[model samples]
Target: MSVTRTIPYLTIPSTSLKRGFYIGFDTDTLTTTNELGTQTIDAMAHQHHTSFLFNANELYVNEDPENGGRPPRVNENGRWVPPVYRDGFLPQAPGRMFRWNNGRIEYAGSNYQWFGGQGLTYPNNETLQHYSSTTLFWCNEFTQFQMMEADATTIDIATSDFPYNRWYPLTFRYERTLSRVSASVEEQYLAGRDGAWIAQLGLQAYRHRRNRPTEGLAGNLATIVALVAFSCTDDDTLYNVLINNLAWRGQLRVYDAEHGRRPERGVVSNIYLDPENPNGSTYDALRHLEWTDGPIIY
Candidate 1:
């Protein structure tokens, strides 16, 4: 049997300068066994979660007097007038412009043409281009999408047969911490005024178990993976970022209808830029931490 559930739409708080949200899985009820042959469960046990942070300031609205306000528009003479700046900052240039049509927001234009006809240019006079029209493409969108795709994404587990083929409630929550970290705090940390270089931290874990046991075996094996991603929305995505991951393979010894056994073993890997390392190397200090079982007994 298969079941599906959609978490109600969670609104990222508009009041938050740095809008963000989190999706997490709870597997505390799932049973597991340690080397001692005892069963145990914890909130972090067999859990999977992910947090997403986006710059709300990047979102812009068009000016339409018919809708609410007058926006900059092109005149009959073919001269371009810029739209009203949001929060005193002009909408990101060379990107798709969204507008309201009959009370519905929709894509209006792409590859904005500024008064200069060359689109918007940066301080260095280089042209700013937005490659995606349907999706916003600021701050390594492709990389973020790729990372999510490579991992056990939220969508993947929600649709999978893991968690004992039973239904479980998914939770979504919003937070503003991603944009709230002050620049002074970052400077202090990077300058070594603070003991730690971590500005913000997020953790996620994933686990997968086969439905049926192999022939001649009492039970099946489960695969688990966890990730720790660092940096907040305040950090520049073009520069530095780090992700630490731990993977584990475990055995599920099901004795009968009600009793089962679980034992796990795992490894860790990391990805980061040289400058992003808090330990003054390409690897973060967390990467050095490890736990392992000496040898497997049959």
Candidate 2:
């Protein structure tokens, strides 16, 4: 059954949930193993408990009304504005929430996103066991996302069998439609949440990828293959109601390798493209020349 609640955002000050809410699996299909707690959590109710009592703190609206208020049109040119605070912020922000328990953060959820379907992006991981996950791109900043598989194995980018390197800014949530609410309502998650994720994943993935790469990929540059590799791994999980398990072969973005495109989105997915492949050289047509070493993973 579909559920609805009042939109939170008393202010950007991170208010607490006066009336604690419930977060649990709607069904018993996906793996609830990773994140029984962290945001972007997609999983079945652990041990037959369909929902968990949650009290969220640090919940605020970080999205901007002028920048992208979702649906972008009250009717062509009427301008549908989100309720702004005294300080000027919207209630539909992503990646800026903290899960509270007993007056402290039980989980901290954050993530990086691109407005249009673009570089180094992937789905949100549905579990809390894994940290530093992200998800795929949207047609515009107006569209919100949801986790497809709640419990997806974190992709071991280091493994030889796997195609890409697993780095920071992980994409774990699946790209999806606005099914939870009307597209007109925008990205609303009961009061302290948005869709399957509590919030867009934070800097854990960014810090890992930008600093010390666990997969040994120290200096990755942007590449076509790296787009969907960013994620919060569970190893990972999100969509398709029947546990719509997915492993993508290609992406839908505005880059064409044969046509020669450059990084338009603000992320880079690979260091050296392929650490082992010798054909990688960016200066030939690569956007960032500093990373013009290594071979293409594709």
Q: Please give, for residues 123-231, the per-residue lDDT of candidate 1 as tens digits.
A: 4454433211111111121111011111121123334554322211111111111111111112111111111111111111111122321111100000011111112
Q: What local lDDT score does residue 74 receive in model 1, on the 0 to 100 scale? A: 44
Off by over 4 Å in 1: 1-28, 31-44, 53-87, 93-181, 184-189, 192-298
Tens digits of per-residue lDDT for model 2, 218-283: 111222222322222211221111012222211122221121111111221212121111122223
Candidate 2, residue 294: lDDT: 26
Winning candidate number (lDDT): 2
Question: Per-candidate TM vs. native?
Answer: 0.17, 0.16
lDDT assessment of candidate 2 = 0.22
Give Cα distance to truth, residue 261, candidate 2, Å.
Answer: 23
Cα lDDT listed for each candidate: 0.20, 0.22
